[model samples]
Target chain A: MDIGYAFLMCSMLGILASIAFSIAYLMGSDTRKIVKKANFAISTFTLLSFFTLLYYFLVRDFSVRYVFLYSDTHLPLVYTISAVWAGREGSLLLWLLYISIFIVLSTRRLDKLDKVTAFANIIMCTVAAFFNFLLLTSSNPFVRLGFHPPEGYGLNPLLRTPEMAIHPPAIFLGYAGMTVPFAFAIAATYYREEWVKRARNYLLVAWAFLGFGILLGAWWAYKTLGWGGYWGWDPVENSSLLPWLTASALLHGVIVEERKRGMKLLNYALAVVTFDLVILATFITRSGIISSVHAFARNKEAYAYMVLIVLSLLLGLVVYIKRKDFFEYDHSYRLRERLIQGSVLIFALSTVTVLVGTLTPLLMHASVTRGFYRHIEIPLGTALVVLLGVCVIAYRESMLRKSVLHSLVAGTLAGIVCFVLTKLSLASLGVGIFVFSLVGVIQGYSSRKIDLRRAGAIAAHLGLILLFIGVMGSWMYESSYTNINMGVGQSVHAGDYTLKLNGFREVNGNAKFDVVAYVSVYRDGKLVGVMHPKLIIYNLMRSDRIVASVDIISLPLEDIYIAMGGVTPQGVASFEFYVVPLVSFVWIGSLLIIAGGILAALQRREEKARKGVVDAEGEG
Target chain B: MKKLSILVGVVVIVFGIALAMSFKSELCPYVTVSYVVSKGEVRNVQVNGTIVPNSTKILPNNTLMFNLSDGKTEMRVIYHGILSHYQEGIPAVVVGSYYDGVFHAKEVLLKCPSKYKVAEENYSTSKVLSKG
Candidate 1:
């Protein structure tokens, strides 16, 4: 039998085995042994299916329709591997593969086998089966071609970068990781005792992966797209951001629920919303219901996916309504509690704003500008930052009126100082508030015993402060569009530097061609370095095959960027130069945020272990 | 705490609605050349149409002039920036205003048609053979 047929057969068998396991679990049988054996088999089959597709690409098998469409013989080995998830069918298959891996890993982490675990398993398996059915019917990556062409179409030239290769898989890992939390949220409705604790680690893992994936995507857009700006508030980008906002809120809500037994329904709602938004994001990107740069072609599979999303939402609502009485809590008047509540509310508001903006194009056929997002996010973000400062001080000092006043005075004074130093106008006030919060949180942690969770939260808040400062500084001070038409030996002065066009060279490759511009930079009449900005053209693609290569000179305070537009017939090369201040801090702050997440996860694991030991000691 | 929560909720909703209304004018509506011609000089709108092949010209003041069409009606567009290398017959989104029989475009975005659709014909084989 052919490899494609073999792969399809494997998926079909995996689905059958999963359904059998689900049935066995529902029948109150001993499901531990069945789950263990079935997980291994299902994982193996999924891995084989993925590798079978990869082998076809590696061997330049044009008889495979997917390979013929996305890969050419001239593609490098690295890109050939990257081509695995470059298209709609292949990406869905990749999603299936990642979901399968997550399922095996999560089931292995189950400490005991009970109805809760079994039900969670059943839920996950049902999701897996749904994906398998879609793969079998609508988006099979293993379909074959009756006739083979001599050469296959190459991958899109815009996606030829190294970052694009890893972007999709990282994002899919994030989307698949969210399923674990959704499963636990459903199980929480049944078993109320340990579900929150059980779901904590899974939720954190998903949040961290999603955050990291978004950072990578932003980086990819910066490096690959010649737009000079990282984010465009595009519909696809908004789709990703929607889930991220809800997931962040869920993270905060989980903490509140664990500490005070409040916001339980809120936490559950967030969990369901985050997962549903992930599905909605996939639908937006796949269904062609809204036009986006990232969407695939319109397909019939969208209707099936929409049906699944609506059913999941309705089911979650039913469960939540049925279990409403279990989640009631006493009202608390504590300042710290109020701050947490307010922050969650703010996050929800921002989520609604972005959701409305994103769906407007599809629902009303109207486009929301980047300014709308900015207007909503700026004031709310500033308030959230100020609230963080207040919360840290209040939490440390028992929420006293005097303590609150002290923190406010300190924050305002710091804001004025920042205003004088940075001269960032109104944004400097936000920077000041963030700095005060960072300092207060650090002080609060330092005075007490060094607790890992507390320290991680502080670090994460500090990272957010830095991110705000970076964003404010860069957005307010960026100067660009100093377009200069220069030939060899012609110099143009922009900002504090003089750019001289040194020369140009043509680079010919197997699949594409590049025109590299050699430009020398001088500051105060002293030579700094030569910058090479190129224009790359792929000969295969029919439209938008040309990409500008940006050269950047990094400094502590600012980055000097240059992009070559094109060379005229008269040997005059036009270039666009920009001086973007404090942009590196944005990237550095994101790394800190990711690091803090890792630290938080590790500390949570430690806390769980220590609690387990303490409980055992108490019993003894 | 109940009263406080209610107050905060009201403030957030009021603020959100107000901000959204204030910025409603900034939203750019996507239109076609036919719509622009029928509407007669709308401001701050977006136009999506295909560029007429061989109709692009570089003006002396670094502005680009091109004829855009929606397969039925055509309009002249003037963009005050360097035009990127674009496919001749594919759709491009121009964001600006229609004024005085010309579309004053502030931004021009080329659509990558080949990214979404399959290749119409296999020219790769012949190109590779020729190169070899």
Candidate 2:
């Protein structure tokens, strides 16, 4: 424990040394190897201490209470080693170490960019040090209680799965990667206008991981959480989503500035705000702060740590802007009048609303401010159609170039399809819009060749519209519940189908008690399929939850999603009997959305490459 | 410009309709334990209380202990976390519609009166917490 504290203290001191060197260098001092060497020293000691902690767990060192309390004698070796990141404080320290290592790498002398990057690393390290300071004070995992612990409490059962590794790490990578865009933007802000190019790579890196991270989290929830749906609009989920949506807009917004020589200041502001929201998201998730399943939900220490980081960055950003004069080109009426322009403004406003919505809980907690303000993500819809709307203008002469009268006639036809599909449930508001989009697509396709990038963007938007309709259908219409103590071959009517629970079988694993209930789905006295919903009692949490593993009978029109999450007395498995209409559209739409992201990224890369070749007098 | 109006009109009209629909039946996850306790009715009934075994359970599972409290009366409770309650010492307001004899916890929300918040409110809540 003493060694652990000492090692952590050493790293904190290293951060100080780095900061000292940074201050000196900024004050125009030469020969700053002292701070660089100090950083390396700090990271090394921190790494060593971290390894010592890991090594102790692996060897089953009964003396260390963390090991005794968390690790079992029969635990697998992989879990034992990964056990380092399994606790509240341990994970904080691990992430801190990761940030430090990232700082060290980014700060190194890379031919020409190192000099400019030093400032960015200093900011990154400052953020990292706040975390280290928390570890050194409040929540040290290495604190000993003197008495020997017999066996370590295992990892939380929900967190012990293979998906756990991928989900949390991907989120961390995505969240942490946002700092890169932040760093380069700050650094470039202090330089000549030519340095804007330096920030593009950071933007791309942040965008890619943010996409992957959000996708991984969604996938994890779909597979493991036993929830019949994806994207529950949870506050923490919204926190991540806010930055992603804003950054997606900025990604396109920045390209306009990069290529068409417009929206430069807008791009810079978006970069800063996106990074700030990352801290806010961290605050929302870590601060026991809000009522979110994604968050740890009881840690005030996390909140304090995040607030300090946000304040420091805000101060640093101000210091940077005050130090340099960034050239701003006017957003002329021609550029400002465009649909994308209004779209970007609405996008930013929507981002602000999300930030406000997320922060509302923190405000309400103290009884400081209150009123009914929620549903931040909904405002993004304002600009959603705007993007697709521009595609018409951008590709007007393409294959779809029919007169306005054609859409009026075609839209009426498309509305009928939507109305019929929804079974007359009054949520037919999607009818008019879907019809218009359909006509737009068809007309554009029929008249001229659609630009792949432009066409893909429209298709993706059209798909999103489909997704919205699907989500509404599932959320409002779906109904399900649990079943307790039933006789052999007991039947229950759920929504539209009769389910006969045939039998229960007990299955044991290395760590969980599973009661699998086999149910036969029948309609009109015809046996259609058997769905097995498992009730798993995990050893780690020593609790029972239902994992309704239904043999999903998927159809083109409707999907029968049987979900189980808990066990009942008398060998009954608790399950949600649901038949969601157009459930498959959700996944299919998401894939199409991802395909759009890929195509968009490829489009940008090709554009950049061509620009690069052109700059070299078309030498490639 | 024609396309732009159509898109704007579509988004505004659709979202306007959604908001309008939502007002009739507010579907939200506000049915959390704490929210229920704050606004729901209090009734006397038996509940499965997994009174948390605090510092003692930090040891072994067999040496586990729990405290059963209804704010007025306290008792010893010992059952596995089958329908586990959150940590004890928390002034948890359990919310449920009681019938027969059981005060089944339809939801359990724990909100300990914040000593820190009180202090912060006396001075800092307006500045920091007000616009949080």
Best-fitting candidate, measured by lDDT?
1
Q: What is the TM-score (0 to 1) of candidate 2?
A: 0.73
- State which candidate has the highest TM-score: 1
| Model 1 misplacement above 4 A | A1-5, A109-111, A286-289, A292-298, A399-414, A421-423, A539-544, A607-620, B113-132
Model 1 C-alpha lDDT per residue in residues A73-148, reported as the tens digit of each score: 8889999999998887777777778777777777775456566767777777777777778877778787779888
At residue B78, candidate 1 shows an lDDT of 91
Local accuracy of candidate 2 as per-residue lDDT tens digits, A127-206: 77877877887767677758765665655444445655555455555566667667766766665444346555455555
For candidate 1, lDDT tens digit of each residue in B31-90?
779999888889988788898999988788688888999989999999887654544676
Worst 10 residues of 2 chain A by lDDT: A365-374
